[model samples]
Structure formats: structure tokens, C-alpha cells
Target: MTTNGECRTNGTRRPKPLLSRSCSENYEINDVDVPGTPKTPRTSTTPGHEKCTFHHDLELDHNPPTREAMLPEMSRSYRLLLESLGENPDRPGLLKTPERAAKAMLFFTKGYDQSLEEVLNDAIFDEDHDEMVVVKDIEMFSMCEHHLVPFYGKVSIGYLPCGKILGLSKLARIVEIYSRRLQVQERLTKQIAVAVTKAVQPAGVAVVVEGVHMCMVMRGVQKINSKTVTSTMLGVFRDDPKTREEFLNLVHSK
Candidate 1:
């Protein structure tokens, strides 16, 4: 007979778990709550946790999601959201709006439906070349967690290979996996860097994102020209200024 609960639930304490998240969603953007816009709440699958190799405060699910199973319920929520905005969802022109909006929302936040391993697809290959690899001007689009609006721009990623390298296109796919979710620019940048690090266990990783947010442009302050830039540097990138400068110089070049 089993005497401990650890064996049944925790199992063998797996290595570099691709699946991880917090027990509660405790972080928030201060002084940004609009008069009517409510914050998005995330559900915790674990008892409580950031449970990853990098231990980021993010939920990276490894299992594929059942999008069809969620459509009906999400569509209903959109119908209610429409009503809250003082609109008649039952009107002929709007009858199908809720369903369409739900589908779009799911597509926008599709990152939650993905896992690092699934997208990597065994693309990592052994290489003797120990040099910096960079992919720049990668198109990125993501939803703002606070207002559920979009922020889009380009991402530039650079990594120092450590006897291994990932496929070139996979760098962009990493951006997509994280950008297609509810995020803030800061967290999104770090998440992209962290994913690249996990993919190849690179000696260092760097990610920079410059974005124009709909939340800032379409509402609250409404500055049409405002843009945000965020970056995450790890390992040699964080330690070596010369190496970091080289990456930045390359990414900024036309």
C-alpha cells in the first residue's frame, strides 16, 4: 500500500517541465484600470505554482486544446459582453457577431493552446559552430491582457548556440507561440527569450520587441504615436556588453 501522496500526484519530479504556471494570478498593471475595463482572470491548473525550467510566472501548457469544445461557452460570453456595451446582440446584423467574435478571440489567444515541445517538433540539431545566431524583424501580434486589445510589431531574437541550434523558422514560431496570447510587452519579450533558451539550451539569448498597442491608441490617453519597447537578455547577453551591443546593432540595421 502507498503511504505517501507524492508518488500519485507529484510523480518523479520531471526535468525541465514544459508545462508550468502559477497557482494564482496575482500580478497586475498598476494605475491602468479604466472606468469600465475589467482585468482578465487566469485559471490555475496546478494546486498553486511558476513551475518551469526558467520559472517564469506563465502558464505554458503542453497539451493541445479542444477549441471546438470551448466555442459555445465563449460565444455566450461575447454575447453578454456585447449586451454590456449597450448593444442588441439579437439584432439581425449582429445575430452572428458573438460567434464570430468568439472564434476570433480564440485565434488571437491561441498561445495557451500550444506547448514548446509541440512547436519545436524535434527541430534542434547538433552543431559544432559556437556562434551567435540572430533572426530579426519577425512579425508579431498579441492581445493585451489588461484590456483584451492587440499589440503588434516586430521581434528580434539572438542566441549564442551551445553545441546545438534550432531551425531558423522555429525562432519566429517561438514568437508566435507566446504572442498569440493575452500578454504585456515586457512579459512577452521575456517569454520569447526564455523559450529560445529552452529550445536549444543556448549559451545566451536576447529578445527585443517594439509594439504599438490598440489599448493605448483606441482608448485611455489615446496617443496615436506612442510605442513601447521591451527586451530580455540572458546568460552571455546579460554578462557581455560587447556581445549584446553586436546583437542590437545587427537587429537595428535595415
Candidate 2:
């Protein structure tokens, strides 16, 4: 019962869809001579097509990568690093080592995703008690900026609050914000002092950082028992010797 460019489907006959070049075009099936394949003479319909044609471009740009996307590149770099060190990355024992190390390295430097303002989160309080409040023996861990090795120990902070005091827990949180990044001890000490000064505008601020840098202890001189101490003194702690001494003495006291 069907006739003249009509097709029957389940006993129904409809006019056939008109096939234009666009509709009939096959995006795949490009008759190009691929680099590794045998070169066939070009057909007129596929003229000037010498390069391989892929269904989609594999280039990446524009968007920021998610943690999952970044992991593969980090793992690849670690594998390349192993190869550079003349170690076989594809060995049975080392097969997943790159992935494990990538995850570990990302965790170690996770502070890059944090901000000082975000960490503070309105932890400042209106207080008129103007005394030297000291927080000492705060555990700190940081990667040395130069060698990307660990430098960990204790941080001691003291500040004379003018009108505002930070919530005690924020002190440790602040230390953690800066300590988790790649840093130099001197810069880290000064950054913590400056952050406290900015947050509370204290009468004075003092910070002392004592660390055993693996960059120094594990390599490059390798002094196994050596320790590095860096300090920052601002405002009264910088100008008044007695205030500085008092802060120092408190930090040093057991």
C-alpha cells in the first residue's frame, strides 16, 4: 500500500524525510591518510583532507580543574619524576605510588585553598582587658619554600590587646592557616605577627617560631639535631625592650 518515497513502519506509511547533504554528512569516516596508516589516493569527495579528523578536540582551557581532574596530572608528574630519578614507575611495587604521593602532596599543601579572613570568621571579641596574652607551644608544620621539605615544631604568640581580643582557638587556627603552606621560617613568623596585628590592632605583637627544617636536617649539611628560631616583634614589642623581654621570658618558661 506504500508508494513514492514513503516508508511503512508497523503498518503505517509516511513520507520519507528529505536527505540534504547536512543530514547525510558523516562527521566520522573522514578518508584521510593517518600518520601511521598506509596512504591511499585521495578521493574527490574527500579532497584536501590529509590530516586525521577526530570527533572532538582534546585541548583543555578556560575552566578551573576540580580536585579529581588535578589528581591525574599530579600523578603523571610524580611518575615522570620517578623516571627522572632512574626508578621504574611501572613496577609492581610502585604502580600506585604516584597516586598515593599525589594525594599526600595535595594534603600537605592544602592551605593554599584557605584565606586568613575566612579562617578568622568573626572570632574577634570586644574586650577592654589590656594585658599581654601569651599563647605558646602551638604545634606547627610547614613545607620549606626552597626544597619543599617539612619544617615542623612550635610557635609562640603574645599580644597586648588594645580593645579587641581574638578567640583563643583562632590563634591556633591562624597559625595553621599560614603554616600549612610552603614558607620560610622568618616570613612565616612575620606573617603570623602581622595577621594578629591586623586582626586586633594590638598594642604590640610578638611571634617566635622554632622549627627543625628537614631541608637542613635531612640534606644540605644534614645537621641532625640543629634547630632554627625566627621571631617577629611589632609595635611595643619592637620599641620597648622590657615588653619584648617579658614576652620572650614567658615563651621560654616551661
Strongest candidate by lDDT: 1
- Candidate 2 C-alpha lDDT tens digits along 3-94: 45333445654323111112122211123211112234333234554342321111212223455667998999999999999999899989
Clashes of each: 3, 0
TM-score of 2: 0.73
Q: What do the candidate models score in CA lDDT, each in turn?
A: 0.72, 0.71
Superposed by TM-score, candidate 1 places the C-alpha of residue 91 at a distance from the truth, in angstroms, of: 1.4
* Candidate 1 colliding pairs: 22-49, 23-48, 23-49
Q: What is the TM-score of each candidate against the true structure?
A: 0.76, 0.73
